[model samples]
Target: MILQRPGRLAITLAIIVSLFLLLPLLAVVPVSFTPKRFLSLPEGEWSLRHYRALVENPAWGAGLWLSIRIGLISAALATTLATLFSLGMWMLRPRFGGVLMGVALLPMVAPPVVSALTLYFFLITLGQANDLVAYDTLAGVALAHTVMIAPFAVVLISVALAQVDRRIDLAARAMGAGVARRIFQVILPNIRFGLVSAFFLTFVLSWEEIAVTLFITSVDAVTLPRLMWMGLRDNIDPAIAAISVLLIVLVTLVAVSRALHAAWRGRKAG
Candidate 1:
């Protein structure tokens, strides 16, 4: 089947909308290069002092390293749990699947503050018994992140699972493929892209998570976003603008590359 090509007017409108949405993000680029200490656009003079500070400042370096570490751990945990939950629902098609899904997606839909408070109280209680899950600890922050972002991973993996044929699973089962073998060899390979996407998505969510992190962490697990929030709240540092610019550029590059790849694949398929 042939698809209708977008009209020139439609394409023009899309470009305009994209640029408008990106305006705020683009504005940060100039501010990041400002010679001033505070957040401001570059004047006739420009400097990379703020960007340099990202490396030189011990707090920034520590926050960045901590964020990376927590992001990885939480992403792995969330992906593993999401994969298992999503695969179970897909295979079992249980009577309470809808209810289970709603419960799983609650974190995604609930207000950040609500989730944070819930996690905060839970961690506080858990920490009383287990130091590992105590408030202000790295493990606590990681667990909070995992809880907050797992819903997103579940949604993405479930969408991928929806596209998979049920008959394939039945065929594998009829051929005497055990649950473990079918999952590893059949299901996982088929959803490899989705799993990768979920991993990266959850990692990004954890990296940028500040609301819950703020509730669960203190000096012990100050993430990049938490540090940036502190900097913004205490003093409007240009260093935050530098970090924002870097993140914006990185995300834009990844989005563009993925779009190009998808278009190339579409053309090849056609």
Candidate 2:
């Protein structure tokens, strides 16, 4: 089957939609460089003071570092657990697998406020009992993020698992391969792309998580999103706009690089 190229009208509409979605975010670029202390577009002059504040302010640095650490930890934990659960469900095809999958997805489907409140009370209760994994601690926040994001990993990895040929598993078993070897060498290799997708998806979810983070953390584990929220609420600091611009640039770079790499691969294959 041959696919037709999009018509000029379709291309025009696509560009219009893209610009509509991106214009609001693009507005922050000038605000980030405003000479004024607050968030506003530059009047006549621009300054980098807000960008400098990201480096000079200890709170910003600490929040950024903490956010990176928590995102990494949550992504790792979510990916590992989701992989194991997805593998088990795919291989075993258990009776209650659908129910279990639904249970795993509750955090994602439930209202954010409900999930945040539930996690808040649970962590608060635990904090009263123990210091470790307590409310406002890094561990607690990371754990909350893991629970909230793991379902996404589960869905991605499960889709990857579904695409694998069952014959491969049977063939490996017929050759007297053990379960561990079959999984590590054969199954996992087949689903590597899914694993990567899940890892990055969960990492992004955890990185920008603010509702749950607001509930679970305070002084000690203030993540970048949480700090940005505080800045917006309390002072409407220009530094928040600076960070937003940086994130937008970073995401744009990654997206452009990936698109270029895919184009290069397609051309090579052609």
Candidate 3:
């Protein structure tokens, strides 16, 4: 009982710290329902006015659709490349692989400004900025997102690979399983969860990307974050609150669904 006291105190302190960070999120939920022209607490009434604007406004819808499309494309490309690289690295057991892994992690580790600046310079050197981003675009932002997100996928998939038994791979290779067959048959099936996790994570990261997108795009590739940014600067429209609310609800539902799925799988396995 005495030994557990410190642990209980630590857990309680952790929960307190978490709640402190989350208080702002909790406060935003009600403000999202406010019917006022400006942001404030709803004193007497609440309305769906802002939410209606989100649904009816063409700009919001367009931004959302574009974000989703780019997110999907970037996620697919990043996850596939990460999976292949992780599998290949494990197979090769290269001497300088640690250094390579560190280089791969630079995007995630470096400050946002550094990555943004790097991509900006890289873009200018390659082709016209208008063609890549502002004038009209899909490929530009999608490709940038893939590069920024690939490291996350690599780390996740590599962790999944590490959990696998090397003996299975060795046994397969001994039995004359070619490189491709060994990867597809032995390594991949065990890492399905990691692949799903990486895909979803990359999709979310791409969807929320702002710094790099801000540098690369002007109008043509305007994503939801950019739109919201413009709105904040221009109008601080009440609709922004409603969008926040919807995003919060959507992400919460997805999280809950994932948790339920994991629980069900655990039970099934047990």
- Winning candidate number (TM-score): 2
TM-scores of all predicted structures? 0.92, 0.97, 0.88
Alpha-carbon runs more than 4 Å astray in model 1? 260-270
Clashing pairs in model 3?
none
- Candidate 2 residue-wise lDDT, 1-113, digit = tens: 99999999999999999999999999999999998988778999989999999999999989989999999999999999999999999989999988999998888899999
Model 3 Cα lDDT, one tens digit per residue, 100-148: 8898888888888888877767666555635554222677778888889
Cα lDDT, all candidates: 0.93, 0.94, 0.87
**Root-mean-square deviation of every model:** 1.9, 1.1, 3.1
lDDT of 3: 0.87
TM-score of the candidate numbered 1? 0.92
| Model 3, runs deviating above 4 Å | 1-18, 129-136
Winner of 1 and 3 under TM-score: 1
**Candidates 2 and 3 compared by lDDT, better number:** 2
